[model samples]
Target: MSTTEVLHHHHKHCDELFADAEAAGLHGDWAASAASFARFRDELLAHFATEEQVLFPAFEAATGMTGGPTQMMRFEHAQMRELIEQMEAALDQRGREAFAGAAETLLMLMQQHNMKEENILYPMCNRTLADTVDVAAGLRQRLEEACPVSA
Candidate 1:
């Protein structure tokens, strides 16, 4: 499969995780919320690593645009990671206010990040990196292996 197709599939799972976390938060279920958030964080971290390590480099090579899309994505990933840590800390402290604040920030960051990937980065990679069949296949295989059907 192509990189964009693989990312699209992963995005669905990401959306589900986000929805589950949001539902848990809405219900005031701290344990469930924390679990969901942790799952989301793990999945996203892997996803980001895959992009940073493989997809972005391949895209930059193909398009000859160094420090473009990949740089923006890396920055966004860092922001999200920090927010995830804050959320986890809040959960550890059992502080509702902190949790709520972190959750809100996470939600916004996730939504925007997903949009940027879906609307811009993924399509660009698909078009520009179409010739890198091995790269795309490797990414697809890694993503599939990392995130099982049950996940």
Candidate 2:
């Protein structure tokens, strides 16, 4: 599969986990909600690491464009990480409103982030680094290592 395919699959996986977490929380199942959210957060961080440590650096080296989309993505990753922390705190306190608000914001941000990466950044990486790097394989391997085949 291409970089787009691999990363896109990961995105959908994270999205499903996010939905599961939200549903559990809405139903007042704090334990299930926390478990699902933890999985979602871990998978998301691993995805970011795969992009920042592996794919983005490779793309930057190949194209010599360090301050482009990858930089923007890194910034967004930081924002999402902060939101994840907030969600964790909310979960710990059993703050339903806080968790819902943070989750809503995260859902929006993730939608935009995934859209940009899927449509623009991944395609650009595919075009720019296709000839030189097996980025998709590296991404697949790292993701599999970071997050095994669990749900």
Candidate 3:
């Protein structure tokens, strides 16, 4: 599959995770909410690692452009991670208001981050990367290994 296609699949998974988190929160199931958020956080962190380690470097080498799309993505990843940490902390404390606020922040950040990656970075990688197949395959493998069971 193409890199774009792979990212699209991951995006769908992200959507499902978000929906599940929302539902868990609405039902006042703090345990489920915490689990769902943790899963979402871990999956996203792994996803970002795959992009940074495997795909971004390949694209950078191919395009001979440093600190372009990859830098922006890295910054976004950090923001997302911070939000996840806040959410996780709130969950740990069983603070519904705090969790809700964190989740709201996460939802906005995640949606925008996914849009940036899907609309900009993935397409740029698809166009520039010479070893697209290898990069996509490696990402698929990493994703599969990182998330064996869907949450």
* The candidate that achieves the highest TM-score relative to the unseen native structure: 2
Candidate 3 lDDT by residue in tens digits, 1-151: 5655666687779778878876686667988887887677766776777778888788878878877778888898899888888878877887788878888888888898888888888888877763454655666667677777851
- Candidate 3 wrongly placed segments (more than 4 Å): 130-133, 144-151
Decoy 2 TM-score against native: 0.90
Comparing 1 and 2 by lDDT, which wins? 2
Model 1 over residues 53-86: C-alpha lDDT tens digits? 8888888888888878789988998998898788
For lDDT, the strongest prediction is 2
Q: Give the alpha-carbon lDDT of every model.
A: 0.77, 0.86, 0.77
lDDT of 2 by residue, 33-104 (tens): 988998888888888888888889889998899988999999999999999999899899999999999999
Runs of candidate 1 with Cα error greater than 4 angstroms are 131-151
Error of 3 at 99 (Å): 0.9
Report residue 118 deviation for candidate 2 (angstroms): 1.0
How much is 13 displaced in model 3, in angstroms?
0.8
Residue 114 of candidate 1: its Cα lDDT? Answer: 85
